[model samples]
Every structure is written in C-alpha cells, then in structure tokens.
Target: MSIWEMLAVFAAGISAGTINTIVGSGTLITFPVLLATGLPPVTATVSNALGLIPGSISGAIGYRKELEGQRPRVLKLTVGALVGGLTGATLLLALPSTAFETIVPVLVALALLLVILQPRISKAVQSRRARTGTPAHPDGGPLLFIGLTLASVYGGYFTAAQGIIYLSLMGMLVDDTMQRLNAVKNVLAAIVNSIAALFFLFVADFDWTAVVLIAVGSALGGQIGAKVGRRLSPAFLRALIVTVGTAAIVQLVLR
Candidate 1:
C-alpha cells in the first residue's frame, strides 16, 4: 500500500475505535477505507475484526466504572455472544459474500428505530410490570439473551452497527442508564470481536499490515472515545446514535 493509503487506514482505525466505543458502527469508517485501498471484501472484513480487538478491549476498560455490579449479566450474555460469534464467523467463511447484504440494512434500520423509541418502550414495559406486580430481572431475562445472541451473530459477520443493535436491545430490556448499557455494549463487542478474530486466525485470510495499523490506531481511539462518550448527556448520545445509524444505512445501501 502507498504511504497515503496506509495513513488513511490508520486514521480510519482511530475514528472507528472512537465511534465504536461511543456508540457502534466503527466498521463503516474503516471498511470502506480498506476497500478503497484495494483489499478484497472478505480480507478486509477479517483484518478489521482482528485489528479492532485492542480498541474493543480499550473501550471496555475505559468504561470499567460503569461496568460495576454487572458481572452476572456480562458473564451470562458472554456465553450467548461466544456461541453466536462462532456461528456467524463460520457463516462468513461458508456463505457467499452477498448472502447477508439484502437483510443487513433492514436489521440496522430496525435497531435504529428501537434505539429511538427505547424510552417510551421502557416506560410502557415498566408500567405493565407494575400492573402485573412483576419484578425486573437484573440480567434482562431470557428475551434479551436471545436478542443479543442473534445480534452477536451479525457482529461476528460484519461489525458495522453491531453496537447500535446491542445498545438498542440492552436499553430496552436491561432497565439501566444508557451509559451503563453502553458499557455493557462495549464489553460484549469486545467479546464478539475477540471470539471472531480468534476463529479467523485459524481459518481465514488477513492482511497483517492492515491488522497492525488498525490495532494501533483503534487502541488509541478507544481511549479517546471512552473519555468523550462518558461525558455526553443521554439525550445527546441517543441523537448521535441515530445520526451514525442513519449514515450506516445509507452507506450500506450505496454499497
């Protein structure tokens, strides 16, 4: 790759890491940039997954405070993430590249809607629970587990907008502050990426240079993103998620 292209990928990595930490869909930034550099689609996807591991971990660490007392939830959800990630990674290798193309935008759009309506939805659920005299489950119950597992499968395949989906599900079901849900989102993202990367290491092709460049860049960006993300008001953060998610849908359609 040319020095200019290399710089561009590195820059995209930083931006992706920051955005992934704050909301999700960091892949939208880095994936196209990698493609512009002439990497094959599958190669770029695998390489990006590997490269972003550091960033995911970094972001999770940055949100460590918010992660407090969420151990049972994290641990339980991780089982689902691992299984879904493995399945998705396998499908990525086995299926044609375009297999998921038609449905991905629709899924992301739905996730965006959920994020937008989460407050009202949560309120309604809470009111219903009050009427029924039902106690809220600390770990978001089985439905959240199932929903997140399904989302993780997509994340394992193509990570763009995965965080948005996760936050949408967790925000509705978990009954926590958005920031705390985001914290869990980061951890789950880290797990899904890590597991997928591990799977790719054995069975997929990767551009080591791209991986190294993104790894370094995203790691730096993760810290930056966490710092900035923690400060935003929930309303502003929700707005940002909508904006980024809309852009992701447009980019996917154009692609």
Candidate 2:
C-alpha cells in the first residue's frame, strides 16, 4: 500500500479504537477505510476483527475500576460471547462472498440506525421498567444472555455497531450505570474479536499490513478512549459516526 493509504488506515484505527472503547461500532470507521484501500469485504472484516483485539483489551483494562465485583456477570456472559463469536466466524467462512457483500450493506445500515436511535431506546426501556415497577435481573436473565450472544455473533461476523447493540441490551436488561455496562461491553467485544480472529488465522485470508496498522493504531486509541472519550461530547461523536457510516454505505453500494 502507498504511504497515504497506510496513514489513512492507521488514522481510522485510532478513531475506531477510541469509538469502540467509548460506545462500540469502531469497525464502522476502519472497515470503510480498508475498503477504500481496495481490500475485499471478507478480508477487510477479518483484518478489522483481528486488529481491534488489542484495543478492546486496552479498553477493558482501563475500565477495571468499574468491573469490580462483576466477575460472575462477566463469566456468565463470556460463555455466550464465546459461543456466538465462533458461530458468527463459521458463518463468515461458510457463506459465499457474494452473500456477505449483499448482506453487509443492509447490516451496516441497520447498525447505523441502531446507533442513531440508541438514546431513545435506552430511555424507553428504562421508562417501561419504571412503569411496571420491575427490577432488573441481577444477571440480566436469559434474555440478556440471548441478546448479547446474538450481538456477539454479529460482531464476530462483521464487527460493526455491535457495541451499540451491547449497550442497548444491557441498558434494558441490567440495572446498572452506563459506565459499568460499557466496561462489560469492552470485555465482550475483546472476546468476540479475539475468538473470531483466531478462527480466521486457520481458515481465512487477510492482509497482514492492514492488520498491523490497525492493531497498533487501535491499541493507542483504546487508551485515549478510556482516558478522554468520556469527556468528549456524545452528540459530536454520534454525528461523526453517522457521517462516516453513510459514506461507507455509498461506497459499498457503488462498488
């Protein structure tokens, strides 16, 4: 790749890492840039998944304080992430590239919609619970496990706005502060990425250069995300993500 393309990928990695740490959906940033660099869809997905692993780990570590006393929760949810991630990775390899190409645009669009509507959804969920005077299941019950498992499968496959989905589900099912749920989100994301990437190593093709560039950059961004992301304006971040995601859709559809 040219120096310019390399730089672009690195920059996207930083952005994605930061975003993934804070809100999830960092893939939306890197995936398009990878495509712009001429990598095929499946290859880009695999590389992105592999590259973001470090970022996810870094973010989880940064949130260590919030993770206190959440071991049982983490352990239980981990099973789902592991199972779902493997399932999704298998699907990616089993499906034809043509199917992935067709389905991804639709998935990206849906993910963007979820990102856009996330706040309202959270508020609505909270309101419903309050109205019913229902208490949240300490372990998020079967529903959260199922929801997170499904989201992890999606993450393992495409690595898009799965974080947003994670937060949304946790928000609805678990009665915890956003920060704590976000901490768990990072852990789950790391697991899904790690598992899928490991699977890719055996059966999938990827661009090593893309993976390295994104890995280093995203790792740095994860630290920055943990330290600075909370201070940044939520609205601004959402707007930037939506803008980039829209461009990605255009690029994918045109190609």
Candidate 3:
C-alpha cells in the first residue's frame, strides 16, 4: 500500500473505533476504506473485523463504570452471540460474495431507520414499563437473547449498523439509561466481532498491514469516544448514526 492508503486506513480506523465505542456501526467507516485500498471483499471484511477487536475491547474498558452489575446480563447474552457469530462467519466463508452483495444494502437501510427511530422507541418502552410497574432486570430475557443472536449474525456477516440494532433492542427491552445500554452494546458487539475474528484468523485470508493500522488507530479512538461520547446529547448521536448509516447504504448500493 502507498503511504496515502496507509494513512487513509489509519484514519478510518480511528473514526470507526470512536463510532463503535459510542454507537455501533464503525464498520461502515473502515470497511469501505479497506475496499478502496484494493483488498478483495471477503479479505477486507476479515481484516477489518480482526483489526477492530482491540478497539472494541478498549471501548468496553472505557465504559467499565457503566458495566457495574451487568455481569449476569453479559454472561447470559454471550452464548447466543457466540453461536450467531460463529454461524455467520462460517456462512461468510461458505456462501458466494454475491449473496451478501444483494442482502447488505437492505440491512444497512434497516439499521438507519432504527437509528432514526430509537428515541421514540425508547420513550415508548419507558412509558410501558412505568404503566406496568415493570422492574428493570440486568438479564434482558429470552426475547433480547434472540434479538441479539440475530443481530450478531448480521454483525458477523458485515457489521455496519449492528450497534444500532443492539441499542434499539436494549433500549426497549432492558429499561436502562442509554448510557448503560451503550456500554452493554459495546461488550456484546465486542463478543460478536471477537468470535468472528477468531474464526477468520483460522479460515480466511487477511491483510496484516490493514489489521495493524486499524488496530492501533481504533485503540486510541476507543478511548477518545468513551471520554467524549458520554457528554453528547442523544439526539445528536442519533443524527450522527443516521448520517453515517445513510452514507453506508449509499456506498453499498452504488458499489
């Protein structure tokens, strides 16, 4: 890769790390950049997935305070995530790239819609919980498990707006503040990506140069996101998600 391409990948990594930490669709940033760098689609996806793992970890650590008392929740959801991730990764290897090419644009569009609607959905959930006197549980229940599993499958496959899907589900079902749910989203997303990355490490062809560039950049970006993201208004963050997610859809469709 040329110096310019390397710099571009690094910059994309930083942006992806920060966005992933704050929201969940950082893949939308890094994946396209990887493609532009001349990597094949599957190879780029694998490298991007592996490269972002460290950033995801860093972001999760940054939100450790919010993670308090959430161990049971994390543990309960992990099994489904692991299974879904493994399944998705295996499918990625087994299926033709054309399959994903046809499906992912729809997924990206759905994710964008979810991001746009999240606030209203969260308010409605909160209202229902208040009327029913429903107490919040750390464990998000079987429905959440199922929802997460499905989302993780998508994360394993492409992962552009998986975070939005997670946030939407968690926000409605978990009865928690968005901040706490964001932390949970990070951990769960990390789990999905990590599992997929492990599979790719053994089974896929990847570019180490891209991985290293993204990892280093994303790590730093994760810290920055954790520190700064908590201060932003939910409306602002939702707008950002919508904007980036829309861009991802356009890129996927136009490609």
**Ranking according to lDDT, highest score first:** 1, 3, 2
lDDT of 1 at 168: 92
Candidate 1 vs 2: which has more TM-score: 1
lDDT of 3 at 116: 72
lDDT for each residue of candidate 1 in 156-213, tens digit (9 for 90 to 100): 9998899999999998898899999999999999999999999999999999999999
Give RMSD (Å) of candidate 2 vs. truth: 3.2
Overall lDDT per candidate, in order of appearance: 0.95, 0.84, 0.86
lDDT of 2 at 171: 64
Listed per model in order, the count of residue pairs whose N, CA or C atoms clash below 3 Å is: 1, 0, 0
* Number of the predicted model whose TM-score against the real structure is largest: 1
TM per model? Answer: 0.99, 0.83, 0.91
Ranking of all predicted structures according to TM-score, beginning with the best and ending with the worst: 1, 3, 2
lDDT of 3 by residue, 101-121 (tens): 687778768767766776787
Off by over 4 Å in 3: 122-137
- Stretches of candidate 2 off by over 4 Å are 98-135, 232-255
Name the best candidate (by lDDT): 1
- Lowest lDDT sum, 10 consecutive residues, model 1, at 96-105
